[model samples]
Target: MLWTHKILWIATLVSAFAFLGMTVDSLHRMSASTHADQLSAQVIEGKRVWQHYDCNDCHTILGIGAYYAPDVTKSYSQRGAPWLRKFLENPAAMYPSGRQMPNFHLSSAQIDSLVAYLGWVSRIDTNGWPPSPEGVTPAEDAQRAAGGELAGSKIYLAQGCNACHTIQGSGGTIAPDLTHVGSRRNKSWILAQINDPRRINAQSVMPSFAQLPESAKQQLVDYLDSLK
Candidate 1:
């Protein structure tokens, strides 16, 4: 009888634990039930807009989704809020040479929410990802600070330069390793190469920066110059 009673006690305890687990799950789900009640509404709404527009079908985020477009998760630190907003308004205006991302014609309210959402997404602790701060500065601002030209480390990503090049053993290997390039080339040499690639290497696969504004060129150059 004592053995049977102990067995019954064990069964009861198991049942109680199961009930507690269910209750905790219910509370979690309930807390996440409403969008407005979510931890970050801007992120939620931004996710909503992202899904509604099927952006993943074209672009990747957090290393998931399609590769046809640039990864946007790093845009905050790379492009900053202003450039991101402007790009959303008109992609062609920002990069005449690049493929177009259609203007969504989002309302002011929607834009605000989107910007907030992007900011929230940007803070999602990627464990010091992208390996760089991807400094915040306009192309013009970086150029003036660097004097002749900005290192343009960010330009490597912005111009899709990494699509063909590698950096610090990361990125594609199709082009070249650019991490220690600054040590190899002077500012004038770098400027001349970027401004007129054909002049240095007639058969070079890299694109010319002639079309890019001098300010943007300087910003990119500055970013590249900063790379180790």
Candidate 2:
């Protein structure tokens, strides 16, 4: 009985020490992994703003904070500076529907700093963390909210269309919002725009999707068309 008790104590102590060592090692590597050297004055100020406004109460960063809002660690990379600027300028216009983000009334300078801080945060080597489930199924839940997944929707996301266009109350705002594009444009017109934006507008910066397989392009057109 004494020997058995001794073995249990040893196992418990070994497990506890191993956990402590891991925690320490993770802390030691945090600075290097997060690129502490890249934290600029603007980024530091942005962090101050984040704390001052208590953003963590709603949003999460680095997978830490509340679940009330979305994680913003990769927002800068996914949405880009242009998108973030417009959204910060007016949260309602960017997203007016359900589970809205409260306007923080952020100043231009503050907005700039926040974007910079988020950009820096996006670069942190999280080592494939958070297991980006959205990439695998872009229209998984969100698209279902709109109306079950469309094959074309997958292509649309794969082509990064959301980066420049807003649809279903989400995505970027650099270009036209495609939330109701079906009402404004016909399927043929949509296909033409995708095939070659320059053909419609000489100065259009949208790249052509003509390189995509014909079937895939058709599916994307269908997805865009279904938005109405």
lDDT tens per residue, model 1, 1-228: 699999999999999999999999977765544333434676677778878888898988776899898777777766567556656766654544435678788776666667777676666555565574445657766665566434455455666566556678776565568888777877677778877777977887565556666877777666666565
**Per-residue lDDT of 8-66 in model 2, one digit per residue for the tens?**
99999999999999999998999899999899999999889888999899999989999
Backbone clashes counted, model 1: 14
RMSD of each: 9.8, 9.3
- lDDT winner: 2
lDDT of 1 at 216: 72
In model 1, where do residues sit more than 4 Å from their true spots?
1-39, 128-228
**What TM-score number comes out for model 1?**
0.46
State candidate 2's TM-score.
0.58
Output the lDDT of residue 178, model 1.
Answer: 82
